[model samples]
Target: MTKITHFWAFFTFVAFSLGLSNCRTVKNGLDEKIYNG
Candidate 1:
């Protein structure tokens, strides 16, 4: 039971970090487009 809980916690952290990085990249892309146009 403890092992399963630990696995899930690590998985969630990884997913959250990935999501944040994706959002940052998307925001940067939008900023560049706005500036160029």
Candidate 2:
């Protein structure tokens, strides 16, 4: 049970980091479009 719980935490952290990076990329793209237009 403890091992499973630790794995779950690690998985959640990785997923969160990926999500954050994706959001940053999207935000930067939008900013660039606005700047160019």
Candidate 3:
């Protein structure tokens, strides 16, 4: 049970970090588009 809980916590952390990175890239893309246009 402890192992499963640890795994779940790790998975959630990884997913949250990935989501943050994705948002950063998306925001950068939008900034570039605005500048170019």
Best by TM-score: 3
Native-referenced Cα lDDT, model 1: 1.00
Candidate 2 lDDT, 1-37, residue by residue in tens: 9999999999999999999999999999999999999
Question: Residue 25 of model 2: what lDDT?
Answer: 100
Per-model TM-score, in order, reads 0.94, 0.90, 0.97
Q: Which candidate order results from sorting by TM-score in descending order? A: 3, 1, 2
lDDT of each: 1.00, 1.00, 1.00
Over 4 Å off in model 3, which ranges? none
Q: What TM-score does candidate 2 reach?
A: 0.90
- RMSD, every candidate, angstroms: 0.4, 0.6, 0.3
Candidate 1's TM-score? 0.94
- Candidate 2: worst-modelled 10 consecutive residues by lDDT: 1-10
Superior candidate under TM-score, 1 versus 2: 1
Residue 30 deviation, candidate 2, in Å? 0.3
Report lDDT (Cα) of residue 24, candidate 2: 100
Per-residue accuracy of model 1 over 1-37 as CA lDDT, tens digit each: 9999999999999999999999999999999999999
